[model samples]
Target: MKELIVLTFAVPLLMAFLLPTISRVSFTLSKLIAPLVLLALAIMVVCIWNFHTETFVLHIGNFIGPQGIVFYVDRLALLFAFAIFAMTLLMWPWYFEKDESSDTRTRKLSLTLLLVAASAGMSLSGDIFNLYVFYELLAVASYGLIAAGNKKPAGNSYAAAFRYLMISALGSVFALLGIALIYFQTGTLNLAHLSEMKELLNNPAGLIAFVFILLGFGVKAELFPVNSWVPEAYMASSKRVAGLLAGLVSKLAVLVIIKALVLIYPQDEARQLLLFLGIAGVIVGEFSAMKAQDMTRMLSWSSIAQLGLVFIAFSIPGKAGMLAGLAVALHHLISKPAMFLIAERWGGSLQNLKGRAQSSPIMAALLILFALSMVGIPPLPGFWVKFLLLSGLSAQQAWLAIAVVLIMTVVETNYLYRVISSLYSRDEQQSVTSRHRTADTFSALILAGVLIFVSVQVQTVGQALDEIAQDAVDVKSYIDLSLGGGS
Candidate 1:
């Protein structure tokens, strides 16, 4: 059963390389292959999670130790794996415009598969070296997807992708340097081994290295200062692609930082840096979003703010931090993508959205639901997400954080209200023209259903999250399972 986990990483990678060639022979088969493979992987993850609730490890080529490739399988890893497949499948470019060529579609599908493979590898890899490798692979795949996203002849997609590449490349350099520092100090890239030598890393150089990796990964996580790529990239990409990046990819990046924090740098200095950055991100993102002129930019800035909250939640040391962060992360995962889907047709200036709700009441209603939840309305999961974060902050005596969060909530509520009002309002002369696509609407509805379901089953979901949090912060178990062969 444990061995099967390798298939999650291996199969997608193998298929990604072979898919473009396969599409040449039979495009229909190519389309079917990706989804079918993802479905199988998702089911396999569920079966594994249901049957074996214990942590495990996989050593590539049966090799062991720091020099060998290792994959640690814990509940936290599996949750990310499941999310990767599920979200990719959801955001798969299933619909095509009249001008979209089969070759274009094939390329997009192939890149998406590569992204999945790389993300799966990142989630499971037990070593920093492999994590860096997979991170770069994911970056390459994203550049392709984003570049190909816009179908318009004069669209700025290529420019956006180029900007993203520059930032990402710079981030990779810092991350590589940080990894070099770690090896220079401790002589091991394996997380398990590094965790055992945390004392050696309890110095300024170590904290600097941590900062490097955080910034490197933070580029994708929409971490402030390194996150200028967020708005342009999202604007240039298709709504689904934008949704995938904001809702899923960012969280995966955060997972990497969380692993490093839990294992190598459990000191107050590192945590404080994270806290300060998180606070800055929340303030900047929320305020910037309020000033955004269009829906896509607003959502982009909003994603940054939401991730800021996740970072803050995780900054609190312990299972409480993990749980609160998980709550916020999972909530954003559900709502943000759905909102982007709704914005597919309603993407331009907010002024143009007047009376949009009159034409598509269902879409309008879905937006209202998502907006209310984002603003932390009662009974919705977003409220509970904030409640968890606030509670954790109060426990930590983080009064400043509490104030920022509360103020940001009010800011978030006000902007979302503006959106909701515009969505429902009717102008005397200027009627909005574009209509929501059926496919996008359906996708949004599916996500809305998930949000509603989670809200209704909040108790059960919270318990499950608590258990996952418990597993996530178990540093010793992570080491034992990875280094001791998960015995």
Candidate 2:
């Protein structure tokens, strides 16, 4: 079971390596490998779902902690890994839907596979430096994936991709500086080791490093101010590519940031900084998304806003905050991808929704279901998840931020409902585009089905998340488990 963790990521990476050669021999074989790899990885992650009862580290080459790379997998990490593979699997069938030559499709497959491996690796990384390596890996893969959409006749894909790459590269430098500062202070890069260095962390230098790291990852997480790339990148890219960036990459980045927060235990001032960012993100993202003309840009802003709430949820101290963060991340993971899938298949604009219910009822159903879930109506997983986030804030007397999030949620609801309302308008213009049911439709339906499943199993999922949160707060346990059998 432990071995599955390594293989979960390694499989796609292996496929990526062999793909070019295989393409020369059989292009069809290359195109077929990605979905199969993703499907297998999803199965392995599910198999190990209930297997993690303790947080432990897997050292490469049998090397001791802080001396080499180590993989970390607690329930939180496992949950993110599971979500990444699951979402990617759903997007698999639609990947080749766009008509591209064999070589182009094969290259896209390789990069997409690389992104999968990077995301899975990021979730399991046990050291801050190793985590950065995977972070850069994720960024590189994303640049390629985003650029692939540019290969089409028209769009701003290249410009968006270039902006993302430049900004991301600059951000990585800050992150590297932060890692260096931490290493300079503590002489260790292991997260467990960093947890033991409280003296350094609470100091001025440590505080500076914390800021660097947070804002650094902020670029990827689409957190406010740093997330200018969100709309452009999503808008310029293909639906499948947009879905992967918005749904999987950003969420995995959030998980990685959460992991760092758990291990580092930043100062109160730092937490406050993050809390403030959350407030701004929610308000600004919702408002901006509301104003956007296109569904893709609108959903992009909405994603930034929702992730802001995630930041707020996790920023709260102790197990409650951790639990809130998990719920928010999980909820966004389920809903955002489906919404993007809809946007991809059906055009994503206010007008695009017009008469959609009549012209493309099946896709309409998928959009409506996901949109309702996102707005947090009762009995859906989102409602329960959001309840946990606000409850945590209210308990902490974080009233100001709580009020802003709730108010912005209403605005968020309005725009989404506006889109929904347009779906059934009698005078709305009907699109001439043919609505043939394809892999995109099936993939979205599968995601919607998962949302329904989650609604029914809410209690079971909550209990599991609670356990992960508990482990997340117990920094000592992570240290002991990883460094327990010390030299």
Candidate 3:
């Protein structure tokens, strides 16, 4: 299991570097190979799921002591890995069958592989500095992916990517500085060791270190005010890239924040800061999404809002809230990417989708199901997640927060209904193009399947997520797992 844990990440990374060499052999061959890599990842995730392991870690290359830079695999990490693999699997058809430009195809394959490698690395990384390495890899791959299509639009993509780069760089510097501070104080970069030294982090320097790390990671997680780059970036990128950014990359960053919160500052003033920022992000992201004109931009804003909910879940400081957070994270992980993919096929403008459902009921139904899931409709996995989160808030008697969430639910429903109505409305006579049939049908079927799967297994998956969430909040467990039983 440990060997597989290392290979799961290693294979994709090794493939990322080997891709250039593979491409030189033949573009067609490279295209074929890309999906094969994702397939391997998917199989590995299934194996892990069946095995149902608790937590495992592997030290790669052993550059330092016995506990050198490590890749940790736990249920939470595995959950994210599963999401990454699934997204990659769904995205494979776009490259395999779509009529994308040659440049777009090449860039897509390369960036996709890079994104996978980065995400796998982020999920598995057990050290803060190693997390930084993967985060930078994700950012750079995103820049290239965003700029890969439509030369004219590439300018906007480049601008957005550059903005994202600058902000991400600032965050990275803060995080690195915090790591340095931690090292200075505790003399260890291992997350497990840092967690054991929580008493040592009670001073002013430690507080400053926590704040810096929070702000830095908050930028990537799209927390509140630091998330201004998301909408523009999504609008500028191709649909596939936008889906990857909104659905996978942003979530990966948030997961890292959760890891840091659990390990370094599980119960302190730092947790309070996370809660406040999370509530702020939810409110701002949802309201802003309600006002968005472009579908891609709207979905991007919605991702920020959903991430806020995840943060809030983590803030509640209990098994229930953690479970809820995991559920919401997983639900959004599946649904948002599906929505972005659909928006891409339908065109960016909300107005363009008018009467689409009349022409293609299957696609229309799929969109409605996913939209409803986003809105937290009953019987959906999202509903269970929201239910758990709201329950947690209610237990704390946070009425104002609950009110805000309820209001956002209404706003979310309204905007999503507007899209659904536009698609199914009978007044318009917009012709459905044949070009979109393959992409739209494939995406719709896959999304519909996922929605159904979640609907049927909500209780089981919710239980699994709850256990994972509990594991996440157990600081001692995380530490022990990361350090191979804490020496």
TM-score of each: 0.98, 0.96, 0.93
Find the 10 residues in a row with the least total lDDT in model 2: 91-100
Task: Please give, for residues 398-426, the per-residue lDDT of candidate 2 as tens digits.
Answer: 99988997898799889988887887777
**Lowest-sum lDDT 10-residue window in model 3:** 93-102
Q: Name every residue pair that clashes in candidate 3.
A: none
Clashing residue pairs in candidate 1 are none
C-alpha RMSD of each candidate structure in angstroms: 1.2, 1.9, 2.5
- Worst 10-residue lDDT window, candidate 1: 478-487
Backbone clashes, candidate 2: 1
Per model, state how many residue pairs clash: 0, 1, 0
lDDT of 3 by residue, 305-326 (tens): 9988888877776676677677
lDDT of the candidates, in the order given: 0.91, 0.82, 0.77
